[model samples]
Target: MTKGERAGADVAERAATGRAARDRLPIDGHGVFRPPADRADPVQIVFDQEADRLPDLLALRHRRMRASPLAFYRGAAAVMAADLAGQPDSGLRTQLCGDAHLFNFGLFASPERRLVFDLNDFDETCPGPFEWDLKRLLASVALAGRANGFGRRVRAGILSGAAQRYRTAMIRFAGEGELDVWYARADVDDLVTRLAKSRRRRVTRVGDKARARTTLQAYRKLTTVIDGRRRIVADPPLVVPVADLLPTVDRIALEDRIRTMLTGYRSTLAEDRRHLFDAFRFVDMARKVVGVGSVGTRCWIILLTARDDTDPLLLQVKEAGVSVLAGPDPVPDPDGEGHRVVAGQRLMQATGDIFLGWQRVPQLDGRTRDFYVRQLRDWKGSVAIDELTPRGLRTYAELCAWTLARAHARAGDRIAIAGYLGRRGRFDTALTEFAESYADQSERDHAAFRAATKS
Candidate 1:
């Protein structure tokens, strides 16, 4: 067996035996499974250590060998896995949103044009400890609260509310019927109404109106046709034009590969989408820049035109490689990274895009990289977390909790988790304490990140 495979086997064995390879596992107040506190300040560590190391991190993710198929969870996964190795866990594993920060939660346009909230980023997603996700979520809440100018007391309360909601929702979910839990979703209109009832009326009004306008604007900009070309125009730091980022030779090669990739990607979809792709031809393609953490990664957008002049479809092909959290065992498949992304998305989301699929493309360096394809700018948008008031933050946290429980229910035994939590709210208190402590760590981490970037 290869070294990676042997390592995977070892990890599997260790996990089976309830023993992680790393020492100094963290135990919670109840002496249950928890992450080691020594490395508990992930936000601080990331901020301090990686602020100026974005290029290195990006390079690390792109190091997969040609034709070698390994899941690429990226640098975030490696950090999380090592942190998990040091923590005591409940042995409850699911496809975790490895980087469940506040910004990662967002608004998206569903097929019906109705707004919905869900976990929007999956770069670090993988099968892992449930608490790891909770940690990330809680830390993000604190970090975002700080960023929004909330005082320590208010931030603490927000963190408490978020944890309380998560615990309460999980218990309720455990008692719910599977179908009921499956269908439970928070609509954007309902969320806005709920926020209006809270103390932060001014913030709620502004945020709701802003989100509505932003969503409409995003749809119009993304759907606009230019001479039969459906493409998103780059607006500098926020949106880099694909044409500016690629060399002429690479751009040409990408256009050719996109045509080939679309054909293969469409085959993985349903008959209707396959027929849809078959009816369209590629017109323009470019490397589109996006997201804070994902800024430097290889993400491309392809514009296609239907036989009819007015018909258009935009597709994004994001590069996928071995996950940084490969543990001990590694698998081989040219599209393994893309497959990992596809699998993780299915496991975590209640619903997923119809065009989701994996492909392998030979790079200019004669190496092959795996990538997952999805529609670009199909009513995609996010909330401005920095604008939320304390009360609004609380409401948002509850929504996040409700969504998280629903996601976890789909992949694992909700009953057992709910039972472990019970109706006493002990887990709520415990998590609140954890969040406060972790938030303190995150601030330190953020400062470290700032320092790293400055230096």
Candidate 2:
């Protein structure tokens, strides 16, 4: 057969695979959300994750999670993973963001210095049924809309519309050339141009804030000159220097161990990136409390400087644990969980951090842990979900959905998945129903969690 004929045959085979998936699980089957009779206690599950996290920061994590149902949902990816596991999937596999909440989508600088919108978190990312991500995203949309006081009808429209965007975007990708699909991205400037005048002002302000969040900005905000030496400012429970975290006798030893870990992490990067990393010398390190979900996890911000204190590079060393979506029997990963996060992030994002790397380190607590390292901040900013109007929220959710579809298309079988969704609103309707029901479940779980920790 000719090369053109072979390509045609491949497309047909993938389309057949997608259509056959419908037989295993019909489109409407997605609407159902019957909790298992022996479902795990969601509150207990949230506490269970605290076992490996920093004990000193557990209280702060609890406080953050207890803020609202939406906040609780953000930190309760494990709770939702259990529920998603109880359902039958469409068997369409993709590198899932696992925690694809609405807030996870944001503006960040691309390698070429242009701002782009895409999924930014991948702590729980792993390969799984594609709808698992869709479900996670849709539920967040419902929760966010409800939190913003949008009525049921408005929330429903947003949910369905978001799902519809994912479905239609996948269909379009299915017909595009491989290169076109792979190179597709959501440019923030283009997005602003597409919005109405009133909305443009809001989004442009967000874009400008993100642009100002460069490493230099972080340097000024997070550091101070103390006795002719630049040091990370201590903010107690939120940000504490390593020296404050340990006794003077142990500080030097801990610094030595961290330097060794950095060397190991550097080996994981490409030779060119390693050369770029070599220019910076370690200056100071600190433990920082970050995000609603990642609060208790071990997170360290390492300060590296080259060409004096003015040129500073901050790297975040965040713990990477077993993905909540990992199956009963996960494949052995020699490079460990940290590698899992870096691999998934590279696959899903159009532009990744130049310093992205991973390492396994033996901790002072007498346990070995995996950690992924990356630039602490690079023009990263998320729109205030609470500030968005109902229409704005809907638009943002749909943009997230489209961005997700592009990510999935780059990592999964776009043709097959599109074939499964077909050309209708059935999948969208079902997804909206499931999202509302799951949001209700999350609220109940949040109440239980609040009651358990009310003391």
Candidate 3:
């Protein structure tokens, strides 16, 4: 075997034997592999109590980080620390999608037009405990399943499958060569076929077909242009007009800045596609409100058109502050926060849009904020959580774990992780317990949020 391959085998053997080199991973003040103590306080309560003032709550969260990027990092760290305080852990750290809740999983079109399912959000992504991501994911599974009327046993079964898949994948990864682990990926078509073979029920076939249709529909909606507007237009509260949301001066300034940012952003693209950037010019800009977790964050969609009015591209410039899991008063890295989002996304996704870039813009309040830009609606879509049946949700959860494992494997020593997990089912069992416990915690937090709002 080649040297690298041999080393991989050695690592795998050590991991499989449960006696690999034990290195002390990073830990917070709470003696856990999480964010620092101050940042981990029950902000959920604050978030819950101020539901009526969601903008205010979001603004409050933003303001804490606005003092400096480092401050935002610290704030995020605290939130994560708090969230992870009582949770069980795997003790394996990898670059994680820090907020891996069930809703954060989704289907997006790959560069090849194939609908691939993966973790769709990365606002809180960073190197940390694998368990952190798994915990958030499991909790979300339970919360969403309960919300959708699934019984506890069904939810537990789903969680068990998810945990098992992650552990099994890790163990398999341990035995593979470094290159193999790095290159491992789920083929969406193959995945569908595998699912079809697992259970031969009419419901399974119908659900699979329905999911495929929904994905195609979302792709069409994302790419469709409305009149001269190249964006998904708002239908009031659900999709508010960006034009109605911004101040007149800020709106004008944003249009000017977007044009400038796009020019700079284009330079980051490959040489062959650089010509495409010149054909498009920014025509309009507005804040297009989006997402449950990102409700009040500053997210704007910029419209661009070629010489003719019909050929258009929609770009989303989203604010990328410090992660809510990073803790309060984080030290600012001079490169800017937008770079963080771009870097993290590039690391996690198999392929990303050509227009991805970062910009630092001075806000109306005199503070400069970092933001990452990308095509706003280029075949982006998600499964409707409320619409999923119990079995569908379970299948979907396994898909998320498979994708997450692929992403994590890309950035870390997959063999070491795989070895740590071992061939036995210990890790899966631990995660199932962790999931159940964390799900209870999420419900408690959700209730706390509701009660905080009520009081």
TM-score to true structure, per model? 0.76, 0.97, 0.78
Give the lowest summed-lDDT range of ten residues in model 3. 25-34
Tens digit of lDDT per residue, candidate 3, span 1-455? 22364355665464643333223321112121232355433555345423432363465444443443223222333344455744444455667777776667665556666656667777767666665776666656766677678887888788778877877777676666667766566545556566565443533453455345532343344444567545545554444444665677966766677676667667666776578777877666656556545555667776667776556667777777676555445656476777776777788776666777777776533567777887765545566667788887887788788777777777666666665555666556556665565555444444444344342
lDDT of 2 at 121: 95
lDDT of each: 0.60, 0.91, 0.61
In model 2, which residue pairs have backbone atoms overlapping below 3 Å?
Answer: none
What TM-score does model 1 achieve against the real structure? Answer: 0.76
Backbone N/Cα/C clashes per model: 17, 0, 24
**Residue runs of model 3 more than 4 Å from their true location after superposition:** 1-41, 44-81, 85-91, 197-250
**Residue range 1-455, candidate 2, lDDT tens digits:** 22254366688888888899998889999995879899999998888878878888888989989999999999999999988988888998888999999989999988789999999999999988999999999999999998999999999888989999999999999999989998999999998898899999999999999999999999999999988899999998988999899998788888888899999999999999899899999999999988999988888999999999899999999989889888556675689899999999999997878889999988656788899999999999998999888899989999999999999998888888999999999999999999999999999999999999998
- The per-residue C-alpha lDDT of model 3 at residue 372 equals 82
**Regions of model 1 farther than 4 Å from truth:** 1-27, 30-81, 190-249, 307-309, 324-335, 364-366
